[model samples]
Target: MLDRYGFEPAREAPDRVRLRNCPFHPLAAQAPDLVCGMNHAFLTGYLQGLRAPAVQAILAPSPGECCVELQDATEDGEGAAD
Candidate 1:
């Protein structure tokens, strides 16, 4: 959907994407290919087990992009914002 709408995957991984860049969503790091306006929410919901694999597949066709967002919250605080 996003790619069909002019969205491109980020060249960097989610962990590699810097927060200071003001990304629209943290999951933007994971689904670097899809155009997401709310990656943080997507990641949050996915973590809570609300987002389905079909939804992810519908969003991106690549395996790397499929699991772009981290499911574990433990990796979240490294660059948490104030």
Candidate 2:
């Protein structure tokens, strides 16, 4: 799904994954809140649908990077970051 949006994994760790090549660029720059929010929701819903509640999607937009990140849920029960 991320590939469909022109995103590719740039880094991966035991607890995190970072993606690169955001196809939503330029537009994302114009409306970061909307774009990033949708991106986060898409990934989050995807994971939930796959029954992986322990993983969560976060909005951690950075220059030249994908707007979303997937990370392990905290033991305290906070999943996605704000």
Candidate 3:
């Protein structure tokens, strides 16, 4: 699924997954806020469609990667560190 969008799993921990690619690259470069928000929405919906309620997608933009990240919120879900 992520592969189709040019997303590569840069890192994966027990409670988080980091993406190394942004599908909307050139566009995102032009408009970070807009494209990043859409990316977040799409990932959120994707998780919901998969019936994965424990995982949540949020805007955690960083260099050389997608703006949205998947964090396993099973334990408190908020700012808890891995």
Q: Rate the local accuracy (lDDT) of all candidates.
A: 0.37, 0.79, 0.82
lDDT of 2 by residue, 1-82 (tens): 7666687865578888887867788888899888888788888889888888778888787888878988887834785442
What TM-score does structure 2 among the candidates reach?
A: 0.80
Best by lDDT: 3
Candidate 2: lDDT of 54?
78
Predicted structure with the largest TM-score when compared to the true one: 3
- Candidate 3 scores a C-alpha RMSD against the true structure in Å of 3.8
Per residue, candidate 3 scores C-alpha lDDT tens digits across 1-82 of 8877787865578878888899888998999999999999999889889888788887889987899888876655353232
Pull out the clashing pairs in model 3.
none
Selected candidate, larger TM-score, 2 vs 3: 3
Q: In model 3, what lDDT does residue 31 have?
A: 96
lDDT of 3: 0.82
Identify the runs in model 1 with alpha carbons over 4 angstroms from their true place: 1-37, 50-72, 75-82
Give candidate 3 regions above 4 Å deviation.
75-82
